[model samples]
Target: MRLFHSPASPYVRKVMVTAYERGVEDQIEILGSAAGPVKRDPEIVKHNSSGKVPCALLENDTPLFDSRVICAYLDSLAGREGTVYPQGADRFDVLTLEALGDAILDACLLCRYEAVLRPESLRWDDWYAGQMAKVDSGLDDLEGKWFERISGAFHAGSIAVVCALGYLDFRFSDKDWRSTHPKLAAWFAEVSERRSMKETLPKG
Candidate 1:
């Protein structure tokens, strides 16, 4: 399998981290690309009509897209019946959590592109704030439930939370969200030490 990757993309990091955690990293190849909004390349569009990074090409030549789809596909490659994603209610819960986490990433990416990639005069504070609100609400929801469990069985949900927290560290370090959500912060600190996560830490 070949994964079209960019180092700075948190979504790709999520998939890569999961692959490493499930011991499938060696089965995949990373293909670096600089594609992004306003700089779309036709080659990328061939695999993903959206011309997005993090699309995967499977052995059968099928192209998988979006971070969620890629992650689910990687989970399937794990071979274990109930390891990365589990089964039944546990699986549903993790899937929902992943959904929320992906939504937060989407908002963060859009806000970033609008502010830095677009001219200042064209940036909309209201639109940006709305995205930030999603982040805020997401953190608040997690802050409440995170304390109830220190280290439950690892699932894709926890993976999503960790990735979302990492995104916060990357994009909003000045905000110091950890200070307010000590439990979640501690949880993230614990998970960060894992080799899968350590190896995939964002660079550049």
Candidate 2:
């Protein structure tokens, strides 16, 4: 399998981490692909219509896209049933959490694009604040409702949350999220020490 990856993308990190947890990291070959809203890599476009990084091309020439889909596919390939993703009703809960984590990342990435990608004169403070509000609300939901659900099992949901938090640390270090949600912060600290996360920590 070949993965088009960007070192700075949290989505890519999520897929890489999932691959590591599934014990399939060694099977994947990473191909550098830098893609952003304004900057699209043609190589990634050949595999993913959206021109997104973290797109995987299987040995059979099958293309997988989006971090969530790629992670699920990798999990299926591992054949480790009921591990990264649970079964039955529990699966829905984990998937919901993964959605929330991805939503948080979406908001954070949008805010980043607004601040850094857009020209200063064209950047809208209100738009940035709105995006950040989504992130804040997502964090509040995680801290208030999902705090006790973090089992340190390194499942898909937990991995997504960790990657989301790591993205904040990488891009919005000025914001002290730790003080606002100590429990979630502490949970992230513990999960982040896992070998999978440690090895896939985002860089650049």
Candidate 3:
């Protein structure tokens, strides 16, 4: 499997974290690609069609895209030991959390693109503020569910939250989100120690 990825993408980081946790990180090769708001990377479009990062190309060249799908496919590949995603009710729980976490990432990425990718004069403060509000609310919700969701070892939900938080650290440090969500901050501190997460920490 080859992963179309970029170091700065939280979605890509989620997939990489999952792959490492499954002990199949080496089975997947990381192929650099343009991601987030970039729209004209031909090689990315050639493999992913949608030109998105965090997409996995299987040996047969079938591409699995979007972080959730790639992570699920990787989980299937790992069989029983890849219990990060459970099969039944617990699976839905993780998926739900994954969706919430990805929503946060979406807002974060959108704000980043609007500020850096778009012309400054065209930047809409209201639109960016809306995205920030989503992130703030998302963090609040996570703080409420912190203990219930983080009691276990690393899972899809846990991994998603970690990636989301890490993205904030990388891109939205000025927001000082950790200062408000102390429980989440503490949880992240502990989870950050995991070898899988430590290895996949995002770069520019």
Candidate 4:
């Protein structure tokens, strides 16, 4: 299997973390790719229409796009039953949390691209502010509603959340989000120590 990835992509990191936790990291070969709204890698585009990182090609030549789909597929490949992704009612909760975490990353990435990719003259202040607002609201919700749920049992939701927080720390450290969400910060402190998280830390 081959995984299209960018070192600094939170989405790619999630997939890598998933592969690591599933004990199948060694089976996948990482292929660096440039993926962004304005810049696309043609090789990646061949596998994923969106030209995104974290796209995986299975051993049998099946292509998997999107971190969520790739992670779920990897879980199945590892014969992991109801672990990272639980079944029943717990599944929905985990999935919802994953969505929230992914959304946070979306906002953060958009804000980053706005500042770093777009020319100063073309950048829109309102757009950057809007994304930051989403980041703020998402962090607040996580701190208030999901802080107590964080556990040592690594799951898709928790993995996604940790990766999202990592991205913030990597790119928006000046925001001091940890100061406002101490519980989440503490939870992250522990989870970030996991071998998967540590090994997959974004390197820009």
Query: What's the candidate order when arranged by decreasing lDDT?
Result: 2, 4, 3, 1
lDDT (CA) for every model shown?
0.81, 0.88, 0.84, 0.87
Per-residue lDDT of candidate 1, residues 39-138 (tens digit) = 8867788889888978999878699988888878888888876567777666677777778778878888888887789999899999999998998888
**lDDT for each residue of candidate 2 in 1-204, tens digit (9 for 90 to 100):** 888998899999999899888898998898988787877898888778889887999877689988999999889989966468988666788888899899999999999999998999999999999999999998998899876665546688888899999999999999999999988998888888888889987889
Better of 3 and 4 by TM-score: 4
RMSD of each: 1.6, 1.2, 1.4, 1.4
Task: Write model 3 residue lDDT over 1-204, tens digit each, in one string.
Answer: 988878888989999888888887888887877664556568878777777787788878887898999988888888986578877768788778888889999898899988899999999999999999999999999989655775465789888889999999988777788888888898899888888889988899
**Using TM-score as the measure, what is the rank order of every candidate, best first?**
2, 4, 3, 1
User: Candidates 3 and 4: which is better by lDDT?
Assistant: 4
The alpha-carbon lDDT assigned to residue 102 of candidate 2 equals 94
Candidate 3 C-alpha RMSD relative to the actual structure: 1.4
Model 4 over residues 10-124: C-alpha lDDT tens digits?
Answer: 9989988998898988888888787878778888888788888889997686799899998888888888564589886778888888999999999998999999988989999
List the candidates' TM-scores in order.
Answer: 0.93, 0.96, 0.94, 0.95
lDDT of 1 at 86: 72
> Candidate 2: which stretches are off by over 4 Å?
none
Model 2, TM vs. native: 0.96
Off by over 4 Å in 1: 146-151
